[model samples]
Target: MLKEERYSVILDLINKKGILKVSDITDVIDVTEVTVRRDLQDLDQRGLLKRIHGGAQSTHPIKLEKELSHIEKKNLNLDSKIHIAKKIATTICDGDSIFLGPGTTIELVHDYLNVNNVKIVTNSIHVFNGFIDDPRYELILIGGSYRNKTGAFVGSIANDILSRINIDKAFIGVNAINDNTITNSNEDEGMIQTTILNNALEKYIVADSSKLNKRDFYQFYTLDKVTAIITDNNISPENIDKYSKYTKLYF
Candidate 1:
């Protein structure tokens, strides 16, 4: 595997398990102990984690929103995102007006859409690009202050546009999911997501397994607000039971 791929997997493992030994990481990935230690050190220097005696741990609860480049995020959780997007596409129908929030997972939903004469409303430039050249769909790009890194529109303008329209469904993405509450990092981004949910007749929180059982900075909406959630098959049966109490779930 490439060095960067190893780094991403190691970071994901640390985040999920809280701490990991060098031997454990090497066992999971096809890398040696020497290489794992070096990778950990590199991630430590980048402030992604904290290196310790024999392993590494997460830095802290990310309370503040960190704007990462879209390119970087697009490469993370790719397989899970693709699976979730395919599941989401199964629900779309012709002549449907849907709201999609900004996230790499949500962006992939565009690929599996097979319907024609569909109208898509979104604040994500990445989401917009997927349908920009296709005439089968009508695209509505919500305008506002641009967040360059995320390629998303935020602020009052985006919210106002969302308020004026009533969508058939809203496929929202989130940074973290803790218990029954769904959250994101930035307050501005959270506001736009929340507003879209409020205006939609049906709301679907589209996320991957990595986002579950964790909490981010801003709590936008709870599971009760949505009609259902669409996640990847990797979600555990334990989580399915916990989240099912609040809303219907699909993979």
Candidate 2:
């Protein structure tokens, strides 16, 4: 393929997918890894796309949310998630009733939780299972329409259960957080999360650095409404300054 043709194809793919790995480009456009790398570098320099490690993502400030299955996300940024989970666990006090939202990071929080006699509420089957075997926590699983992709229960049934619950602290995960807005890909799940956050005495948004400065399809809640955002220390200084202006951040 000609250089111009390769550039066009690369641009089209990145714009459509929002993010693409070098292998993704090579799969469509017959090219060597070195050539793809060179093209990505050129595009990054021209400001057509943002060149990231082993991949390129569109330059659009807000891209549409893409839902990944729970297993698909389990290993992505595992270290960052572990660090964030450890930090969040420390904030939990003994005998507190807390809501744990659905996400890989949130699931890890259960492992680090050492507090005794805590009531753990969740809409995630994965999260519920994490604490089910342990006698340390009082587990409440909210049942509704189950989303197999995320292992979360959504819809009105879950919302109704959350409304009656008195939660001391609510830790919810999100797809994206840009400026003051917090968003998620699924509307039903977002609705349930919003309800839990609203009913809780303390609301916390749990996410890694990758979730920062992004936007999803459903704008469920905002940063100002939450007690603070718990993220990994890998967040850039610029992002820390920008988000700090909106709400408190714990890294």
Candidate 3:
């Protein structure tokens, strides 16, 4: 491609990654090492980035909040997350034991599930109430301290209950996935989710395409931590290829 196009790609990478190694930019932009280095110099000189040892850090740092408003998560990708939720539900069969996490996507999964006789164990109060009262499904709510805002169980009791159960597949929620790690927005949620994943036979992280390749605070798992991902086709090809090395990626 053209040299100008390579520079445009560099800026896009910085926006997504928040930083980029010189060598990594070379690979991403498909330019010679010297050409990439010169492009970084131009960007750095223009006050776009602060040069680091091997990479350039964006002048715009990404800051993550502990709590995002329910509206924020719900509105992030209304249609794409709906598609992801549907794909996650389709993976299940009748009589499978499933672990559903607390998040909008998993709520969508719970909302979409017509699968019969699935024993769902979760600490998410929303997921509990979504199916708990229904006769078609069996709901197990792990007892623990409650998080009113997110409406999930937190602390030791939740962990203990998680340790005692075995699940066929876990429908997990992720805040972001970048730098090869699955991160969550809240620390306490990460703690509970880590325990949930440890006991499951297969794990599936259901996130909208917007969360893909975006790293935020509090990593709960890595790319290799889960078996597969259910997301929409909005994912960047670069990221899909990057994560595919570790897990099966499905839309």
For this target, which candidate reaches the highest lDDT against the unseen true structure? 2
Query: Taking the tens digit of each residue's C-alpha lDDT, what string does model 2 give over 19-122?
Result: 78999898989789999999999989999999999999998745666989998999999999999999999999999999999999999987788889999999
Error in Å for residue 219 of model 2:
0.3
Predicted model with the maximum TM-score: 2
How high is each candidate's TM-score?
Answer: 0.74, 0.76, 0.75
- Candidate 1: tens digits of C-alpha lDDT, residues 1-251: 99999998998878765667999898989788999999999999999999999999888633433556788888887889889999989998999999888889888887888999989999999999988999999899999999887888999988888888999989998878766678777889999998889999989998788778777778899998789989999999999998899999998
**Per-residue alpha-carbon lDDT of model 3 for 140-225, expressed as tens digits?**
88878888777788888788778788889988888787756788877778888887788888988877777765677787887687
Instruction: For candidate 1, report its TM-score.
Output: 0.74
Candidate 2, superposed: residue stretches over 4 Å from native = 1-61
Model 1 CA deviation exceeding 4 Å by range: 1-67
lDDT of 2 at 151: 97
Q: Tell me which of candidates 1 and 2 scores higher on lDDT.
A: 2
Off by over 4 Å in 3: 1-61
Report per-prediction Cα RMSD to one decimal: 12.2, 11.3, 5.2
